[model samples]
Structures are given as C-alpha cells and as structure tokens.
Target: MKIKSLSLAIISATALLSGAVQAYETGDIIVRGGLASVNPDVDSGNIYAGGVEQADQRVDVNNDTQMGLSLTYMVQDNIGIELLAATPFSHNLQGKGGLAGLNDFAEVKHLPPTLTVQYYPMDNSSAFQPYVGVGLNYTIFFSEKFINGADATFGSLELDDSLGLAAQVGFDYEIAENWSLNAAVWYMDIDTTGTFKNANGTGDYKIDVSLDPWVYMAGVAYRF
Candidate 1:
C-alpha cells in the first residue's frame, strides 16, 4: 500500500510540470473594438486686434461618439504592441455671446490614429489582466463649414496639424478560455489653432483652441 501511494505522487508531479511547460510556449493575439464618448475641454483665443472678448468667448461643441479598433500582438508573457484605428470625429463650434449673430457656427472633422506599447503585469494569472500604455497620436482636420444667419456662407477653417501624447489604463476579465471583457480609459493632450473666415462682411478671424479629451470604452475581446 505504501509503494502504490508513492508511485501515484510521482506521476501527479510530472503532469503538473508538463502543464507549466505548455503554458510558457503559448502565444495569443487579440482583436477588440469599442465605442467612446470624447469630451473636450475647449479654450479659444482670437487673433484679431480689438477682438470682442476673445478670451471670454463661450464656445459650444457637440459631444462626440467615436468607434475604434485595436489589434494586439503578444510578443511575450507580459508585453505587447497595439495599433489603433478609428473613423473621423466631427464637432460643431458656436460662439455664444458677443459674436453670436456673426459667423457664429462652424463644423470641423478630425481623425486621430495612434500606436502604443503596452505592458501587462498580470498576464500569467487566470482571473485578472491589467495593463498600462503610452503612445503617440496624430490628428488631421478636414470638411469645414460656416453658418451664421441670413448672411451665412462657406469658408476655410484652419487647423494646424498636430502630434500629441496618449496614455491609457485598462483591465480585462477572462470569462472563458478564448474570450474576455475589457474596460479602459484613455487621455490625450492636444493643442490646435484655427482661423475662421466668412465672405459676408463679418471679417476674417482666428481662433486658438485646445482640445484635451478623455475617452471611456468597454468591449469584448477574442483571443487566438
């Protein structure tokens, strides 16, 4: 009876060691997509001399909803690289008080493509996976329009092309062997300047706006 028990213990230890070796040899790729609401903390500066309360001009921007896709390639147990893609986000701008009747409203569309390097400290665990990322983003603006009342007309709004920094914190919960749910928050520090012009005697004006936005997203990811 004693000899039988010792043989069973040796077999169990060998099986556990084999499982650990198999775990170290596995690689995973994950694809995820989600939606985010982008809220911009906007500040505008007017370049025209004697500009009417440019510093205090109340600017209105519509809240933007954006969809994004990310592809991650895990190079090791706890490190990966991700590439992110998204559609263009459009926003409307309106002047509230003194210039309300002038060329008051305009629309601008921007596309930001980002790339990140991520580190996962808990990748080897079964229940929880947390990650942090730092990256760079580039923004391009297009499709601009101006509307102000009866004298409303079309013009060019100048937005300086910008490069910015991005940061994110996120976590995932494994629900099954090949599936997980994810939630994340990201932030970008973007600075931009634009010039608004109108053909109607309203004169050409410039605005310097800062769009530092926060993004919140949740989605499911599939691993292979």
Candidate 2:
C-alpha cells in the first residue's frame, strides 16, 4: 500500500508540472495584442494626364503605427493558421521628385488583414517557439482626400485596393502557463493606382504607386 501511494504522488506531481508549463497542442487558440508599424517602400510612377505620362513628377508616402492584434489556431502539432488584424493606419501623402516642393499633399487611411499558415519548427514542449508563415494579404484604402497645396490644385482623389502575398517570421517565448511574449515581422506586396481630378477643368489623372510595406509588431499573447 505504501508503494502504491508513492506512485500516485509522483504521477500527481508530474501532472502539476505539465500544467504549470503548458504546451501548445491541437485545438489550442492563441490571441495576441501589441503595437504594429507599417513602413512603405514607395516606388512612384510619373503622373499621367490623358494618355501622356509626366516627365519627372512623383509622390511619396509616410509610415504610421497603430494597435495590432492577431489570432492563431493550432490545427496540427506544429502547424497553425494565423490571422493578423489592426486598427486603421493613417499616412501622409507627399510630392516627391519633381513635385518635392508640394509635400504633404494628402492623407489617407487603410487596413491590412493578412491570413497565414504558420509552421512552428521548435518542439511543442519547448518554451521558445519560432515560426514562419506565408499567406495572403488584403489591403483596403479609404478616406483619401487632398490636402495642403495639392488640395487646391486637385479636386478629388481616390486610391485602388490591393491583394497580394504576405510572408512572416516571428517567435513566442512562453512566460507562464497561459501567456507568452511575441514579436513578428511581415513583408507585404501592395500595388495600387491613385487617381486625381484636376481643379483646373482637366480630366482625371492617374499615378501608379507601389507601396509595398514592411510591417513590424511586438506584444503579449494568451493561449486558451
């Protein structure tokens, strides 16, 4: 009877330890929240009027930071599907190249929601987990308006929505039974055409801008 009681005690202790350092398994859900920034690597095209492209006129875009959030569901031992979300990011539009003197031309808001299939290479029991993911990103641009000097010269403005591929790399360090620290970076391919109407009684003009941005995020995560 004493030997049986000792075995029971040992088993109970092992179970308690397992609970204290939780392992991510199938059906686990992780929710993370933190700060995220989007920095645009802009490649601006010449402004076009009618069928003619301008000589050297171009535009510039500035970066912004906002609260970011994400949700992940573990489908397999080392595979998870994650969705990244955030508050709308606002940026200032400026003139570049030939139009450098006309800076801060406009402001706009956008949201990028990305879905990725993440692969965790570290063992499930490991406290430090590193992951890589590839997925789709849908960026929606809105509230585009002309401002500063360009506002008086341009009547109205609109930007196109973008759908592109997104790639990510991140890690999570387990802090307790149900919480961890997380930091991630993503590269998104975003291309769009911005159209503007001239206030001087001319037709609509267009410019193709590739605002492919690198996104960085860091925060805390909780598992359920």
Candidate 3:
C-alpha cells in the first residue's frame, strides 16, 4: 500500500510540473525593443528642374539605423496583433548611375508606423516560435534639407507621404518563462515624390522616387 501511494504521488507531481510550461495565451501582451536597420533599394525618376532635364539624374539613399519598438497582443493562442514604432530615421540622398558624385545632395527624416496581423506556426508551448505577418505601413516625411550645390540651386525640398504594404518573417526563441530573443526581417513598399523649389520659389522640380526597403531587427522581448 505504501509503494502504491508513493507511485501515485510521483505521477501527480509530474503532471503538475508539465502544466507549468509557459505558452502564449489570449490577452497576453508582449513588448520588444532593439535595433532596426533600413536599407533602401532606390529607383528614382529623372530630375526635371527649371524646365531642363538633367541627363541620367537618378538618386540614391543611404541606409540608417535607429531604435526599434514593437508591441504585440495575443488575441488567440496562435494569432497576434502587433504594432511597430521606432525613432525617426534619417537618410542622406545621393546621385546614382550617370548622376554620380552628388553625395549628400539632400537629407530627410521620416517615421514609419506599421500594423501587422501575425500567425505563429508552432505549438504554443514550444520554445521556438516562427511567425509570418502581413500588414499596412504609413510613412510620414519631414525635416527635408538640401546640401552642397543642391541647396544653393534648390532652396526648398519636401517628400510626399507614403501609404503601402508591409510583410514580415520572424522568430522568437525562449530564454525564460517570460523572456525571449527575437529576430525579424521586413519588406515595405514605399513610393514618394520629391519636390524641390528654387530659393525664390519661382521654379520647381519633381522626381518620383521608389524607396522600397528591407528592414532588419533583433532584440529582446518580454511577455506580461
């Protein structure tokens, strides 16, 4: 009788231990912070200024890095809604291809706020979770300034705001019951028209720039 009682107690303890595994559940909130890098694959239209076409005047934008933040809420065991935010990103404009040597021709700062619905493709109790997300992105541009000869030639610069689609793939590796390490990569469709004006506002130029970029991030996440 003593031996049978001990066996039952051992099995009961094992079951309790198994139930202690932490998994994502409804109403869970996750917050993540890390570094994000934005690298643009630019395709720019020819620059037309003062009714004159500049030959091969394509543009290039340099990559920028900034602090990244993501907030997630679990609506179900495997479905999560996430919002991405970050510090303002700044990019330096340059000339590309036939219009080379126009580095730092201008600078602009912008913010991209994205909302995604994510699907996790693993059991909730698994230590590693991989997810795919599709969402919408809105980019707001401001603080545009010209540099070098471009400034003297074109006094005012502005970039049109963009509305586009965003896609992401990411994974989280569990480190503790409520802690995890995360890595993600995203592709965003960003198209903007840059307008430039003379110092006296007498003339204007327009260039359509496609700044589709790949964004990469890695950071730590905490669940509450």
Candidate 4:
C-alpha cells in the first residue's frame, strides 16, 4: 500500500513539472476569440447648420459589444506581432446638452481593425503571461442613416473614416498545454467630422466628433 501511495505522489509531481516546462517559443502562432465591448469617451462639437452654430447642441454615441478575434505570431520568446479584428459594431447617435430633448438622430456602423507589437514581461515558461501593446487603429464607418424622420429633415448624412493610435494592457493564463484564458483593455484615439444637408432649406450641417473609446475583451486563446 505504501509503494502504491508513493507512485501516485510521483505521478502528480511529474505532471506538474511537465506543465511548468510548457513555453511560448519563437514561431508560435496564437489565436484568440471572445466578446469585446467598445465604450466611447466622447467629445462632441456643437451643431452648425448653414455655418450658423447652434449653442450647446452636441452629438454623443452609445456603447456596443461584438465578437472579437485576434491573431498573434511570436517573433521572439518575449515579443509578438498581433492583429485584432471583429464584426461590425453599431452605435446610436444622440443629441446632448441643448439638444438633449430630441429623439435619436441617427445610427452608424463601424469596424476598427488594429495592429500592434506586444511585449510580454513574464518568463516564456510561466503559465501567467502579462503583456503591453502599442500600435495603430483604422476605423471604417458605414451604413450611417438618420432615424425618426430625421432623414426627411436632414437629407443625406456622411461620417468620415479615421486612423489613429491605440494602446493596450492584457494578461493570459494557461489552463492547459495549448489553451489559455485572456482579458485585455485597450484605449483608442478616433476622430471624425460629419456633414449633412438640411432638406428643408439650402443649409449644410456639420459636426466634429471625437470618439476616443476604451475597449475591453475577455476570451480564450489557443496556441499552435
């Protein structure tokens, strides 16, 4: 009975040691998928119709959540190149301050694809990997349309695309040899100017929107 007990103990220790030696090596490719939430820290400009400014009438955006995917290729034991992608996110536009009483003005859809170089601080063999990244984000805006009869009043509306800087901090915890759970938070700098024509008259409306957003993602990752 004593010999059997000793064998079990040795087996458990060997399993632990094997897991500890598992490491992220050069030429490794990692794929991750999960939910990503984007919340804009907005700074909107007052509305101007026909070049006439409307006092305190600003534009704001709501938050959205969508499926997020990321692909990473290790260049070294501690460095990697990552590309982040996701499905389109839709946001409802709102009027704020003096225009706060107005109904929803419009809705817009966008896709932000980011590329970054990440630095992992922990040892490659460690199960818990924490990383920091900095790179660029290009946001493409589409399917912008007015709602609640605003289309009839505002005519056609258009929002410009944006290219900006992005940064993030994240961590990964290995649950098995090739599987890890990950969580990350990123800050993005996004800005755009929008224009619309007033159908009721000959005036053109304009607004400068700054949608600096914080994005959060939580999901599982698999190494290849």
Using lDDT, give the best candidate's number. 2
lDDT pick, better of 2 and 4: 2
In order of lDDT, best first, we have: 2, 4, 3, 1
TM-score of each: 0.78, 0.91, 0.91, 0.91
Displacement of the residue 97 alpha carbon in candidate 1, Å:
5.5
Give the Cα lDDT of each candidate: 0.71, 0.92, 0.90, 0.92
Query: What TM-score quantifies how close candidate 1 is to the native fold?
Result: 0.78
lDDT of 1: 0.71
Report the Cα lDDT for residue 174, model 3.
Answer: 79
The alpha-carbon lDDT assigned to residue 140 of candidate 2 equals: 96
lDDT of 4 by residue, 107-154 (tens): 999999999999998888788899999999999999988887678877
Q: Write the per-residue lDDT of candidate 1 for residues 1-224, one digit (tens) a residue.
A: 99999999999998775444321113678777788667777665654523554555555566688887777888887887777767778888776556555444777788877678888876364446788999987878888766554225536667787789998888777776657788877787778877665665456666667787786778877677
lDDT of 2 by residue, 15-102 (tens): 8876676668899999989999999999999999886999899988999999999999999979999999999999998888888998
Q: Model 2 scores what on Cα lDDT?
A: 0.92
Runs in model 4 deviating more than 4 A are 1-16, 19-21
RMSD of each: 4.5, 2.9, 2.5, 2.8
